[model samples]
Target: MGKPAKNKEVKPKRNRITFETKAKIIKLKDEGKRNSELAKMFGYSTSTIATIYNAKSKAIVQRAVEECVPQGVCVFKTEYRPTVLNDLDTILYEWFKRNEGRKVALTMTALQCKARSIFAILMDPAHGIF
Candidate 1:
């Protein structure tokens, strides 16, 4: 008795449809191209094409198209939100800039100690160190 050999066909790598591609798909749809046609043309699912075509806000579509230049792509509703630590981030950035090119840069432990001290100062009402 002999065991059957398994098929060894290698699968092709799945390609991500980039923001630029999505913008292009929306543009083609605006030009009266059908979802089926777009799916075949862009190698994406019909549902994906339809979603891009039928997005509720025209402003969002326009922004995507405008942002699809050579340098970078624009994503809708994905802007960075400011957190409570924003001030801390700014302080750390300034500290790093000031210490740049120094022979003895701040170690992780020193940075942590500085951050903890700053946090304590911010938290203490008596200090008024906001």
Candidate 2:
């Protein structure tokens, strides 16, 4: 196989249970859907359904689904974001939480800018960011 590009994020596996999918699975479970049913519906495994569903999972799922879980993603990730880009996850989530319930429209460019700012703030040696 050819070497993967250094700059490109690896695409998620076709069946990887993303946070948005987790939210749906959790909702289905709450609505009395069975694990087998969910596994069949989402084309993932039962264990994946079970693992991402739990009492404590609501909080993380909440972060992941903050803004309706856009088609291109917009939040925290356990199984969603690439590990290398998640060094500032906490900061990013905090920003999301801070802006929760507000009608702040986030364009792709805005999100990219935010990510860059967060990266700069976190990686800045002086830590004196404005």
Candidate 3:
């Protein structure tokens, strides 16, 4: 007996849109052709043709619209703002001047202590915190 017939069948491949088709779509859109007609001419769906038309139609108009507007002119204030460092500069200067020992340096532990002290001073409203 002959072998059982195969159940699977090969499906035809979908066609890719070429550059010529894209150019034709753009040309037709620029010429004000209807999206439905363009779809028929290019063997594409109406929605696909509409998308292409909309994208192409917006390209130049978008660029023109973006170009016509001038960017806003910003004025920056260069005044120096007092900060926590400014508040502590006097106290820190006095501390450094009194502890002028050659071994004095900003080690990690000293940095942490300084940071905590600064935080405390900043939190104290009567200390003229920034």
TM-score of 2: 0.37
- Writing each residue's lDDT as its tens digit, candidate 2 over 3-30 gives 8868978876665445667778888998
Better of 1 and 2 by TM-score: 2
Q: List CA RMSD, all candidates.
A: 12.1, 14.7, 22.3
1-130 in candidate 1: lDDT tens per residue? 8989998999878764555677788788888999999999988789978877776365375555555642222233364222325666777777767777565578989889877776666445565444
Off by over 4 Å in 2: 1-16, 55-130
Deviation from native of the Cα of residue 58 in model 1, angstroms? 8.0
Looking at model 2, the pairs that clash are none
Error of 2 at 130 (Å): 26
- Candidate number with greatest lDDT: 2
Clashes counted in candidate 3 amount to: 0
Per-residue lDDT of candidate 3, residues 12-130 (tens digit)? 67664544576689888889898888888878889988776667645455445435643221222242223555556766766666666655765668756875797686657676544
Ranking by lDDT: 2, 1, 3
Q: What's the lDDT for residue 64 in model 3?
A: 54
